[model samples]
Structure formats: structure tokens, C-alpha cells
Target: MEEKIKDVLDAYTFQTTRVCRGRGAFICDTDQGMKIVKAYHRSPQRLEFEQLVKYTIRDRGYYYVDQLLPNKEGQYLNNNKDGQMYTVRDWFEGRECDVKNAADVLAAVRQLAVLHMLMRRCDLSEDRVEQFSFQDTRQIFLKRRKELRAIYSYIRQKKQWNDFEKLYMQLYSDCMQEADAALSELNQFDFDGLRKKALDERTLCHGDFNYHQVILNRKYTAVVNFDKMHYDIQVKDLYQFLRKVLEKNNWDSSLGTMIMDTYLSVRTLSEEERRVLYAMLTFPEKFWKISNRYYNSRKSWISSVNYDKLCRFKKTEGQRQDFLNIFKYAFIF
Candidate 1:
């Protein structure tokens, strides 16, 4: 560990018995327990907000959160001599939730429902309330849809094209159709009212909840990385987790059913939440993501990884459609 890190750890109350390198930080086995020390890049207020949400979850008896620990001076964030900020939080002795493993995935889903149940209506300061509120998704979707058209126009005018560009051009029409369908479906609902209701309830989403942040250990299934938590439709969290796991499993409807059933067992979804999830699934998120990355990057030398992702997305279209059909029939109807 760097001497600066040691200096920072010394500020904490725990006595560091040993230290080792972790994923992106230092793993220090201290007197209190296993703690992770990493350079914090966000503002101190953001860290304070994250800490507040985690503490709220813990206070409600969900102690599996990786909360930031305060230093000797009673501050969650501390600056080193060089003006670098560091934060130490509780770490777990476990592996990431395996999306392919049915048991692990189900457990994670159930825990997510429980977390959502507890994460609602956190008291935010008046100033931070507007800052942390959900943005207008309607305008956001229109912007992305417009950008998709722009990308198509840009690729079409190119004098020469690579394999990725050729494939993107081939798939552009179908991708736009899906995007239109998602927007159409979204327009059918009281999206504005849904946002208002969620805000009134003070629902908070894990924001970046996925298998990577879910830790599976013997004692508990721990959820980490709350840096992106914000006020929004909580089902947005469920939709994201389901899309990721289903994509990895070739969009298996059986697995999808199990996930939905598992979550429903803990907490039921309102009709609007269910519809919102289907609309979110209908969006060509993977296509948009690949295209967005391609458009933003230096295109003179395109990467094969992009081509591979495009190919995989193309190959899985049929299975994805089938799963969406089943989901709509079984859940959304």
C-alpha cells in the first residue's frame, strides 16, 4: 500500500493488521473488520448522500449494505496531504452474484425486493431534493431516438465502411422499429404521473444494481456500490437486472419467470410498474449502446470487440423476441 493510504487509514479508529490489493482498492484487515479503502472521485456531498441512504437501509434492519465508515474526526471523507480524498467502507468475503447460477440469481432478486421495500422515502434536505430527483425520461428518450437517426445518417454518407458499419447499417431499420415501439408503449402510460407517484413515495433505486455489485457470502448476500442511487421508479432496478441476466442466459423465459416470481413473492409490482418494465425491455438498449459507443469513439480504427458485440446481438434477436413475447403475455397483460 502507498504511504499516503497508510496515513489515511491511520485516521480511522481501526488498527490495520494486514493490507493487500483488492479489485480497485486496498483491502485492509483491521480490528473492526474487513474494510476497503479507495480514492473517492465524487464530491463530498455526494458521498454524504450515499452514506445517508445506506444508513437508512441499515436502520431498517437490512445490514448487508457496504456503508462508509467515519474517521476519527467524524467525517466519512478525508483528504490526504496531496489533496486526494479517500473513503473506507465495509467489505465482504465473497464472490459476485453469478447470473448463470439459478440459486444465486433468485437470492439476489429477492434481496433486491427487500432492499427496495426499505429504500423508499429517504429524507433528503430541501436543496438536495431537486438535485437528486429523477430527470424527464420522455425528453431523454426523444434525444436518444434522434441521435439514432443521426448515427444512421452519418454512417450512410461515409465513402467507405467497415464490417461493423455494414452490419449496423443492415440492422438500423429493425433497431429503430424497436425504439419506436418502446416510445409508443411508454406514451400509452401515465409516465408523468408514474414519476410523480414515485417521487411522492420517495422511492430510491440502487441505480447501478447488477450482478457485479451483489456479493454472495456465507452469512449474507451483500449489495454494494450505492454511488449512483437516486430517486426514480424502483422497478427500473428490476428491469435492468432482468435484462442483464436474461441476455447472459440466452433470454430463457423459464429463468425470467423464476426471477419475476421470486421478486413478486417478496413485494408485488403495481400495474404501472409492470408496464414500465415491459416498455424498458422493449427499448433496443444493447443496439443503442453499441451504436453510441461506435459513434463516440475514433472510427478510423474500429475495434473487433464492437463487431463481435454486434454479431452476438444479431444472433440473439430471435430468442430475445421470444422471451419478450412470453414476458408480455404472462406479466404485462
Candidate 2:
């Protein structure tokens, strides 16, 4: 390791023995055990809130969360020479959850349900309250719908179209209809009331609960990356995990049902929450993601991968719609 990194590690209580590079961080085998050291860019207050969430969950008996360990100075952050912030967090020695594995997918969602159950009614301090506020899905849906239209317009006006743009334009109408339908469904509900309920109940969600962030091992499945934890309707996590897994499975309705049953076995969802989840599933998130990527990046040269994603997305649309229809009829009804 570089001397600057060594200096930062020295501030920690543990003596670093082996240090290796990680995804945007360093993985260190320390005297205390395995720990990950990474540069943190969020505010100290957010860091504190994250730590608090982990500590609370751990105390509540979920020991598999990623924790931001305090340094020798009783602080979770340390500044390097160039003024970059760094943090040492406990690391899990395991592979990421395999979405293709049926058993792993079920287990991952089960654990998420457990985590959500424990994350309920968290008693936040005065300072943490402002930072740990509820997320309004209505505003989120509106913003995404607006972006979808904007991207469609941007792609339509292009003088010459790449393969990716050509495919996007071909499917833009259907995809935009999906977006509008989801937004319309959302408008039928008391969304603000649901957000208020989430706040009143102090429910917490793993804001980015995809399979990538889930870690699996022999004993227990560990969830890493609590950086995105926030106060929101917990079903948001379920929707994220379910969407990713279903997309990979060609939106298999049976598999989707099993995932929902596994989650519901642990924690139940309210009627409004269920409706919100349906709306979320209806949104053309993958289409929006591809469009956003195309619009934001340099358009002169486009990656073939974008074209590939659009093809796969197009191929899966029928199955996806079937899954959504079944979900609404079977679960939401």
C-alpha cells in the first residue's frame, strides 16, 4: 500500500496485515479481523446516520450488516494528505448473491424482509431526523415520466440515428405508454398519505437493494452497502430486487410469485404499499435507464452494449407485461 494509505490506516485501532484493492476501496486483513477501507464522500452527519442504522440493526440481531468502524480517535472518518475522506468498515468474506440461483434469490429476499422488519420504527435523534426523511415516490415517478418524454423527443429530433437510437425510437411509444400508465396508477392512490405513513412509522428501506449488494456465505447472508438506506416505503426494496430477478428470468410469473411469497412470509405489506409496488413494477425503468445513458453520454460514438441492452429489453417486453398483468390480478386484486 502507499504511504498515504498506510498513514490513514494507522489512525485505526486495528493493525493492518494484508491490504488489497477492492471495488472503489481497499480490502484489508487487520488484527481485528477483515475490514474494508474506502474513500467516503458523503457528509459526516449522513455517515453517522448510516452507522446508527447498522448499529441498531446489529443490536436487533442482524449481525450481517456493513458497519462503519470508528477510528482510534472515536471518529468514523479520516482525511488523507490530499484532503480526501476515508472510512474503515467491517467487510464480509463472501461472494455476491447469485441472482441466477433460485435458492440464493429466495434467501436474499427473505433476509431483506427480515432486515426491513428490524428497520421499522427506528428512533431517530433530532439531528438525524432531517437527514433520514421519507422519500416521496410520487415526485420520483413524475420526474422519471418527464425524463422519458424528454429523452424520446431528444432521440426523435436526431438527424441520423444509430442502431441503438433506431431501436429506442421504435419502442419509445410503447415504453412511454408504460411510464404514463404507471404514473396514472400512482395518481389513483393517496401517495402523499402513504409517504406520511412511512414517515409516521419511521420505516427504513435499502434504497438500492439489488442482488449485487447482497453477499452470501455458509452461515448467513450479509448485506453490504448501507450508504443508500433511507426512510421510505420498505416495499421499494422488494420492487427493486424483484424487478432485477424477474428481468433475468424473462419475467417468470411463477418465480416472481415465489419471491413475493418468501418476502410476505416474513413481513406483510399494506394494501396501499402493494398498489405502490405494482405501479413501480409497471414503470419502464430499464427503458428509462437506457435512454438516460444514451442522452447523457457522448452521442457521436455509442457503445454496442447499449444496442444489446435495448434488444434484450425489447425481447423481454411481452414476458414483462405478462408478469405485471399476473401480478396485478393475483397479488394486487
Candidate 3:
């Protein structure tokens, strides 16, 4: 960790040092500070993509993000070193956005709208920024299904497996089959036409837009985490926000409607986009598959966490169906 900090500060020569870990490595000062250092233990490609996103947002005069620190080489990130990709940015103190308040929720919608608009203007091809299309999402689901099923089979064969474990294995299999069917239907849909329509109609999108990514200061809301930023359907981001709100609270249809209404008021969605929203609801299932693969591989700690959350949410099947019903209302499926 100390070595990672040195790599991050190699460009700035900062005096203070503190580290906090979340999705990636973050270095800050012990006291109130002005700068932040973020390092990823992944490939340089990811860091480069993040830097590109930061540059794009900053160039458009969006102050929601911390400014990328430039080295003497005039690069915002250091890629010369192997196994360490790091960049520094100006730090802003803030808190997470409030979800209960209607005004706060509307504000988040507006912010997402602006973000989507900005992403629409970006030159994604130059940065090798690939959009997560329906095809890619389907492929991920299929891959995850295969992996999870293998894990379940292994668990079932184990001598020490209990009744609860066996029940969960059956549940996992059932969910995987459901996801597979949904993905197959999604793959057969007119995704090409949908993609062209979405691109031509909608603005830029923060692919992983959610309340957690939005930080609230006294009077302004700032968005962070551009790592997953991409050019895709605007509803993709909108649905992500809606899903979180449903997950956090009971399935609140009014809240979901208000968010959609606010976003559409800012940036209108086409009939085709509305039709594609149901297909998009299945996108989160891809992430579940990815998470399951990671858990099975022992590569991520999220499997246990996500499983617990899903179990808690599963207690209210009607609520789950109600939330899903929102997507059905949007799409023909």
C-alpha cells in the first residue's frame, strides 16, 4: 500500500498520506485536504479509460469530478509501471445523497440527464470506450450461468452440504434458468435497431449512475466514479437509479414514476427506448452472474454480500414482482 502511494504521488510530490479502500485504492490526507490519489491494482487500460472520462467531463466544464493531476510528462495517469495505474485529483468533502426526499430524488434525475448529455458528445471510439450493448449483456449472462451451475453441482456433490445449502443450490439453478430464458429472448430482439435509435436519440450516459455515485455538498450534487462511464441507452442509467431506490425502500412505484418523469422532462425518451426498458431490466442479472462467478472463483467478496441482500429482498416476492412490473409497463415484454 505504501509503495502504491509513492507511485501515485510520484507526479505531485505530496507531503501527506492516508489510504482508504473501496472499489479501488484511494489516498488522501489525514486532515482536511485538497487532493486525492486513486490507484487501481488492475491493468493500465482501465486507468486510461478513467482518465479519458475525467478529461471529457472536465473539458465540458463539469466540476462534479476531481481534476486529474498531470505529471511532468503531461499525462494524468502513470502507466509506465507494471501492476500499478494511478492518478490524482482535487478532493471535495461531501456526503451521500438523500433518497427519501422527493426533491433530492428529482435533483438526482436532473444530474443524470446532464451526465447523459455530456456522454453523448464524447468521442468514445478514440478512447476505445465500448458501450455495453444487449448482446454483450446476454453473453455475460450465459457465461455466468455455466459457471454458477458448475459451482452448484460441486456443492451438491460435497458430503458436508446441509439442507439449507441444498435448497439454495436449487434456488440458484432455478434463477439461472430464468435468467437464461430472459437472455435468450433479449438476444432475439431487434437490438441493432434499438441501439441506432438510442444513440441517435439519447444523450451521454453514466453507465453505472446511482445515488452512491452522486455526492451531495451543501447546495450542489457531484457525481463520482466514471470508471464505468460509457455511451449507451439513457434509460440504462435511469433504470439503475430506479432499481436502487426500489431496493433501498419498499417497492415504491410513485418514486420510480417521479424519477422517470423528471428525467423525461429533461430529456425525452422515444417509444423505442421505452420498449427496450424491459430488456434492460435483465441487465442487472448479468452483474449477478458476474458476481457469482467471482464468488465461485474466490476472486471477490461480493458473492456472500449480494446473496444475503437478495435473500432479504426475496422475502417479499410481491414487492419484487411489483418492481419488475415497472419495467413491464415500459416495455412490451
Candidate 4:
């Protein structure tokens, strides 16, 4: 850890005596102030891309985020040493919104709506904007299903598992199969057809909007992590936000419906958008599969932890079935 920090800021003075460690980086509280130092194991591409996205969002009139500072060479805190990519950002002092009430949820949605409006009107060039095309999302789902099947097969063949372990293995198998069937139907969807529908209904999307990504201060909402920002179906973002809310509450379908209704009141969805909502419903699962693959691979610490949390979250078969039932009812209508 010391070696990594030195690689980025060799001569930088330290002010504080405390350092906090996270999965990806270290938070140093020194005399120089609070700085978040993130080190990537191999690829700097993602780190560099995230810095650029942060800059773009900040420059485009969103004042909620702390600005990314450049180094002496005018580079955005991206320095590679010993095959590791290191970067730093000024740490802002704030707490995550507990979001305990409907008002908190509604306020967050309103901020997201405002963000979508800004993203739609910004005259940014195509290269500057990053979007997840429908095809790309579908491929992610396919890859995930393959990986989950492999894990389930391995567990089944081991033949030494306990009853709970066996039950979970079967549960995951059934869930993946059900998700695959839903995604298979979604894959047949024509992007060209969706694009036409989108032109009439499209809006700028946060690509990965949810409670975790949103930081609320006393007066304003600050959205971080623009790496997933794209020009895909706007409902994709809304669907993810709702899904997170439901998942956090142990698959409370009533809460999900209330949140969706509140959002719809502010930004009405067209009939065509309603049809595409089914496709959007499956997108989160697509991401879930990607996460599962990373976990199953057991390559990185962060991925492993995420995968464990995901498995734990989806442990209850009855809860997952309830979610699916609600999903089918909401979108298949």
C-alpha cells in the first residue's frame, strides 16, 4: 500500500495520521487534507475513463461533484508505475442518504429527472458520450448465464454438499434458467425499432442510477459515478433505481410500485415506452449476471466481495420468485 501511494505522490507531504482502506483504494487523512487514492491492479483504462467522465459531468454544469484535480503534467491524476494505475480525487465531506421515506425517494427521482434533462440537452459530441447499446447489454446477459451454469454444474458434480448448499445450487439454476428465457425474448428485439421509438421517448440516462450512487447533502443531491452514463432507453435507468429500492427492502413490490408511480407522475411515459419497459426490466439482471461471473472467477477482491453479497441477497428462492412475479405483471401488462 505504501509503495502504491508513493508511486502516485512520491514527494507529497502528509498532514494527518489516519488512513482508511477500501477495496480499491486508500483514503489518506493527512495534513495536506483528505484525498482518495484509487489504485487499479492492471488496467488503467477504466480509471482513466472514470476520471474523464467525472470531468465531463463537472464541466457540463453539474456542480454536485468535486472537481478532478490535474497533476503537474496537466494529466488528471493518472500515473502508472510498476504496472499499476493510480489516481486521486479530492474527498468531499458528506453522508449517504439513508432514504427512509417516500419523500426521500421522490426527491432523488426528481434530481435524476433533472439530470436526464441536462444530459438530453447537452451538445456533447458522440465520442464524448458513452451509451450501452441494447445488443451490448444482451451479450452481457448471455455470458452471465453461461458462467452461472458452469458454477451450478461444478457444485452438482462435487456431490459432497450439504442440504442448504444443494438447495441454493438448485435455486440459482432455476433462477438463471428463468432469467435466460426472459432475456432470450428480449434479445430478439430490434434496436432499429427501439431507436425509432426512443427518438419519440428518449431522454438522457445516468446508465447506473441508484441510491448508492446518489449522495444527498442538506440542500442538493450529488450524483457520482458517471462511468455508466449513456444514451440508451431512459426507462433503463428508472427500472434499475426501482429494482434497487425493491431489493434493499427484501423485494417489497408495493414500494416498487409506489416509487414507479411517483416517477411517472413527474415524467409521464408514452405507450411505446411502456412496451419497452419489459426490455428495461431485464437489464438489471443482465448486470447481475456480469457481477456473478466476476465473483465466480474469483480474480479480484472487489469482484469476490460483490459476488458474495449478490449471492447472499438472492439467497431466498421465495423472494426472488416474488420479484419475478411482479416483474412479469408490471411489464407484461
Top model number, TM-score: 1
lDDT of 4 by residue, 1-333 (tens): 465566566534445466677546677776666677775453344445456545656667876754455666666546556655566666645555455666677777777766665554344444434333343445656776776667666666874864434544645755666667657666565744665444444335677788766766677777765555555667778777876676667666676677767677677765555545555454346334544554456332334445455566556445655755676677455
Candidate order by lDDT, decreasing, is 1, 2, 3, 4
The digit string of per-residue lDDT tens for model 1 on 218-244 reads 889999888888888899899889999
What is each predicted model's overall lDDT from 0 to 1?
0.88, 0.87, 0.63, 0.59
lDDT of 3 by residue, 208-258 (tens): 777777777776778876666555666778877877776666667777777
Candidate 4 residues lying further than 4 Å off, grouped into runs, are 1-35, 40-60, 78-85, 99-106, 121-135, 152-161, 172-177, 184-189, 195-208, 228-231, 266-332
Per-residue lDDT over 188-219 for candidate 2, one digit per residue giving the tens place of the 0 to 100 score? 97888888777777788988898988889998
Locate the minimum summed-lDDT window of 10 residues in model 3.
126-135
How much is 103 displaced in model 3, in angstroms? 4.5
When 2 and 4 are scored with lDDT, the better candidate is 2
Q: How many residue pairs collide in each prediction?
A: 0, 0, 3, 4
Worst 10 residues of 1 by lDDT: 129-138
- True-vs-predicted CA distance for residue 131, candidate 2, Å: 2.7
* Candidate 1, position 60, lDDT: 91
Ranking by TM-score: 1, 2, 3, 4
